[model samples]
Target: MINNFIKTCAQSKLSSIYEELLDTSKQALAVNNGNIAKWESAIDELKKHNKGGVNYQPPYININTSNSDTKLIQQSLKKLTPWRKGPYQIGDLQLDSEWRGDMKWDRLKNHIQPLKEKTVLDVGSGNGYFTYLMALSGAQIALGIEPFLLFNYQFMSIHTLINNPPNAFVLPLKLEQMPKEAVFDTVFSMGVLYHQKDHLLHLQQLKTLLVDDGELVLETLIIDKKHGKQIIPKDRYARMRNVWCLPSTDTIHTWLKKVGFKNIKLLDITKTTPQEQRATHWIGNNTQSIKDFLDPNNDKLTVEGLPAPLRAIFTCQK
Candidate 1:
């Protein structure tokens, strides 16, 4: 799989750092994780099945296959639990994930520039759901960078089941680890900004990865203007740790401008609903999801009494 990624990158605008990307991914994937054996076992089990073609089937990152052993495939995939980003369908089996990613995709797809034959980067791509969509939308190469090894394995699981797969690939590498080369025609940073300790630096790093006049699609948690510019949560918001800041749309625009981005546009602002993020059987042991995180008295507020999750998407040029 790494070789395939290398081969593609070497022939694209990313040729300069293809080897470094491969080496970094190798090192990241080499880290000792107790669950690696189980995940690898699941992937090995999946190898016995036949491959298929992938396409968008509304809610699913659908794979076309009819003769698959649905029951066996389900069992193998269960090993990589807590599926957060997708609601993929392989054959007749529906791997319903925590997030109905298509909903997010629908909101931003038409607003952003067409991806056909473009080099795309999906930062913080969980399990490569949107990355696959980007490739299916006709990108020359859609590279997904996810630091979590399990998600990379999940991506590989899906990739393994696809006959030709698309130009989509996921690696266990962080955004900071990527070579600061302006190689990508489009870069997407979704659900990643709030996790950064320095949001400005994160935005700057994103800009540095794009080609001149390239587009950036930024999506992350945001609060209403009533929250007053931003809210730096002192503790967990909606049962999630590592969430540092929730800024207003205006504040985000300011940040983008400060970082030298041009033609910044706030595309959408939708409060997250249970329909978009809810637990499914595929999420495994932790059955609790968005519903569990909200306050019993008020759905508008989290259990901690903080404003609930509201996300905004912004597009700009580097």
Candidate 2:
């Protein structure tokens, strides 16, 4: 499948970076894991239920078909559970994932540039949910780069069910692994910046991948400026150990200016809600989510005494 992606990209303006991406993806998939085989098997099962095609069904990326074995489809999809980033629907089966992804889409859809016929790069695209949306919006190509092998398999499972999947593709690679190129017309880095140990470097990398005047859509955790310039969590923020930094919206604007972004615009500042991210049966053994991570006495703060999950969306030109 990846080989076919490389070939398909070779005929486009992205041919220069295809070889590097192919190499990085090969190395990522080579890692051994107990779940790899299981995810692959589940994906194989999903392939059997392919129909004519799929269309963007608003909150649900619905596959269109006259008939389907819904029972088998549900059972097969169950094997790859703990869905974190979607609330998709396949025919009659509603995959009410942990996160209501459409809510995030609705927040920023009207504020950004149109994606039609543009090459888009989605950094840290979990399971290619938004990547699929980008293609649905008529992007020439929407390429998602996710390091997790399981998520890549999850992407394939969804891809196989569609007869002629859109130009969306997910590869097992990170922003750092991508070959330096200014090919993408738009770049998105959502729910990824706080996890980066070096936030500036991540911003720089995002800038490098876009063409001049290309817009960047950045969404990440942020704190109120009244709480101070920023907060570096002592151990964990909302029980997430990898969270390194949470900047104020003002601080984020300063960072963008320092990085040479022009015409920066703060789009939205919204606190995450229980309806948006909560524990669900699909979240596997560890069903904990935002509710569990927050302080029982105070929903405004996390269990660790830091500010609760508040995210900001910003757009700027390179």
Candidate 3:
């Protein structure tokens, strides 16, 4: 039955089955006291399910900004010009004013308050949701670097209509393609690092974009002690290949140090919610499917070549 389900998920392009495999693997670990065969079998099934073509590559821009080639930068800047206003909606998530008064809505805002009046670079500012939040928190200027053309357009239009223009400019280029101008005071990257093929190289690229003594906020999945290896599946989602590499916290700290970041700190750590958990076979907020595969006690698992919780968050400074 399990194998058939896995095969069905593979043939039907279903992600929920992968989530169930993850749950079952975790349960097997708890029962067998670390016997790994069940976990391995589950991962194999997941690979079979994800055997499809990958998502499209994000739009790319050239990064040459020398004095001799100022045209490119000029053209990029022109592309950044804001458009007419559109209907705006207050985001679903709300901030609690009293608990952490005047703090930026990120992992490290409490310890790093007075984030106000600082210029911020929101890397991978999907739809500018967080970008809008940062601007509201008194960030003097927020620059969002998003490579998707449709998202860039929506972010621009939304901000223009909100009566609270993004103090923010949306760049239609990836982080590596942006000019090395020390215009930003801080950098923010969330839910993005794991997507890069060369995570370390991308970290180095982010470092080059920051001014000396600037802070960077990052969040992604990390391998726990229990999970031994990563399992690469064949599935692709929206230009992002579903590759899960869970590095330990210590390993990530080492990477940050290697990239010359200072004052590294683990601000907040939260387990993945079972309903919206990334490792599960479900995508988005498919509550019915989540309830079906829900295993309340089996929180930790070694499946799909990655640890469960399937995601994590972190903050650091450069």
Candidate 4:
């Protein structure tokens, strides 16, 4: 799979970074072996079944197959459960993920520049759900970078099920691992910034990787200024560790300005709902989701007494 991705990159606008990308991904996959056995086992199970054609079915990325036998496919997918990003459909099987990714996509799709024929980057692309969407949106090549080894395998699992997958490839690499080349016309950093210890650095890296005036779709956890300027979670915020900061929409704008991004615009600031991120049968062992993390008595507050999960989407040009 990686070989095919590398070969494709060689023939596209990403050729300049192809060598470095290959090296970085190889190194990342080499050191990240904790989930290899189980992930590969799941992939092996997936290969036993026949696949189908891929399509965008709004809330779910659907696959249309002539083969109706899905029992084995269902069992194989369940092995790689706790799906974080997608709500995909393979044949008749519904792979409902923990988060309704379509909601986020819907909020920003109309506001952004047209993706047709552009080279794109999707950072923190869990399972390449949006990556496939970008490819279908007509991006020349949509490259998704995710650090998690399991998600990389999950992407491969889905890719394998597609008879002729689009020009979308997800690699086990982080934003920092990518070579600093201004190749992408559109760069998306959705659900990624708050996880960075230095939010400014994250923004800076996004800027460095884009072509001049390239569009950046930045989405991350945010707090209403009524709470404060930002909330640096003490331990776990909404049952997630390594969440460094949640800035206000205004503060996020300032962060963008600090990083020298131009034409900044705050598109939306919507509160996450149970309907959007609820516990599902597919979320493996830890089925708890946003509802479980919120205070049982107060919907406005999290169990840790912090403001409930709210996110903001900001678009800017580098």
Candidate 5:
């Protein structure tokens, strides 16, 4: 299984580096159960050859002895619920509106019942809004893993209120950095997988974190239609230059099946307005030119004039 997984990864020309890391990970898993000291030695050797960004660090939190300051911070977070925006809010950072509305609390509750007495993992849990919601919904324990430093602190403080709140621990690490022993009954990832350069590796890591028959929820952007020759958004890739892979529905479905996810269901709930009105929101003299291509009645937006726009929400059993 490991060999086949590696081969599949290698087949994607853009993901060869990740494939090598996956191969090394299999070796680490083999020795991980044998000798602790030997495993550390092997890991050190692998680090020396870490040409790819595949090597992941362990997740951890920072602590200070200032009790009064920490308490004040925690209190501030407690008073800030019923947030109107998405899971993130620090000074003035925010994601798109579609993300906030897609798989929202009302919709999410319908898909997943109250997680009473169940362990849950919120992957990419920015600012811990959903984490707190899960706790309030009676989850036995909710663990959040967010890589962003500032956002992790916000989540940590808010999560601390759970009446022994299900270990609202926030680790400043990515999904791949989590310890193999950390497993959960339900895992949620929103507005995250699309940002990864190696989407397949991200999926596999999520699978490893799940217990038998666990549940997974994911939301991502998909290609709906093709537009010939489009320019890349300069601001989109500013955070991470490698986050450029946006797969079609067919491609993503196949990848999910290949990773062993069962009973996969894809739901479409996209929003689009007519080009003329869309152009009115545009700025400057370019408005007229941009408005010419607007087609509100069009079923989908074209990507690079070759593919269609198709955003989807996915749910499956791991």
Candidate 6:
């Protein structure tokens, strides 16, 4: 996959830093992990099957193709379990992931600039569902960077099945590891900001990735101002320990402005519900979804007593 990405990058705007990008991605994926062999075996099994054509079929990023060994494919996919960001259709099998990404895509797709022939970066892209959507939207190249090794392998599994895979690829690289180059025409930072210990720095790093007048699509968990400016969870938020901050929409707007982003526009703010995030067999043993994370007695708050998960999408120009 990295070899294919290197070839694609050599012909695109990313040609300038493709070497650095490739080196960094190689190092990131080279980390010692016992599961690497298992994940590679799954991808290898998936590669034996035929490839398919990709399309958008509403809730699913549909892939039209056939596989003689549906059960074998399913079992192989199960080896790379805990799919979190998609509800994809490959041939006859519906790999229902934890999050229905189409819901989030529909909310902001029309609002952003068209991706035709543009260079795009998807930060923290889990398994490249949206990254594939971005590429299908006609981007010259849509590069997804995810730090998790498993998600990168999952992306490769899916990529292996695409008949004529789009100029879409995922690398096991973090936002901090990226070359600080103003090359991408559109940069998407979704579900990533709050994890940062310094929210301001995250916004700053996002800004540095875009070219002059380039667009940025920022999405992350936020709180209503009525709750306070922002809340730093003492321990956990929504059953996840990595969450660090949940700012009000207004507070996030202020942070964007502080980072010198121009024409910052808050595009959408919607509370996450079971329909958008739910458990399925793809999520493995950690079947706990949004409903399980929320307070059973009161839907308005999480089990940890923080406000229910409300997310905001903001679009701005660099």
Give me the candidate number with maximum lDDT. Answer: 1
What is the per-residue lDDT of model 5 for residues 1-318, given as tens digits with 9 covering 90 to 100?
234323433443213244333444345444324334442443343223212111101111122122333333323443332232233322121211112422355445666635776677788877666665665466655656676544543443333322223334444456886666425677888668777767888888888877777777776655543422222333433123444566666667788899999888775534323321232211223443222333335334332232333346677778
Q: Give candidate 2 regions above 4 Å deviation.
A: 1-4
TM-score of each: 0.99, 0.97, 0.57, 0.97, 0.54, 0.98
Candidate 6 deviant stretches above 4 angstroms:
none
Clashing pairs in 3: 15-281, 16-281, 19-280, 19-281, 50-234, 223-246, 230-305, 231-305
Per-residue lDDT tens digits for candidate 2, residues 1-318, read: 666576668766588988888887888999988898888888888777756477777788887754468888777777888788777777787877899899999999999999998889999999999999998899888899999877888788878777778888999999998888899999999999999999999999999999999999999999999899899999988989899999999999999999999999999999999989988877788999999999999999999988899999999999
Candidate 1's residue-wise lDDT over 1-318, tens digit each? 767787888889989988898889889978889999999999999999988888999899998887459999999999898799899999999999999999999999999999999999999998999999999999999999999898999998988889888999998899999999999999999999999999999999999999999999999999999979999999999999999999999999999999999999999999899899998998888899989999999988999899989999999999
- Please write out the lDDT profile of model 3 over residues 95-151, one tens digit for every residue: 111111112243455655355877677888765655655665677656566765545
Clashes of each: 0, 1, 8, 0, 20, 0
By summed lDDT, the worst window of 10 consecutive residues in model 5 runs over: 52-61
Give lDDT: candidate 6, residue 116.
Answer: 98
Clashing pairs in 1: none
At residue 315, give the lDDT of candidate 1: 99
Runs of candidate 4 exceeding 4 Å displacement? 32-34
Q: What Cα-based lDDT does every candidate model obtain? A: 0.93, 0.88, 0.49, 0.89, 0.49, 0.92
- Superposed on all Cα atoms, model 1 deviates from the true structure by an RMSD in Å of 0.8
Candidate 3 clash total?
A: 8
How well does candidate 4 match the true structure, expressed as C-alpha RMSD? 1.3
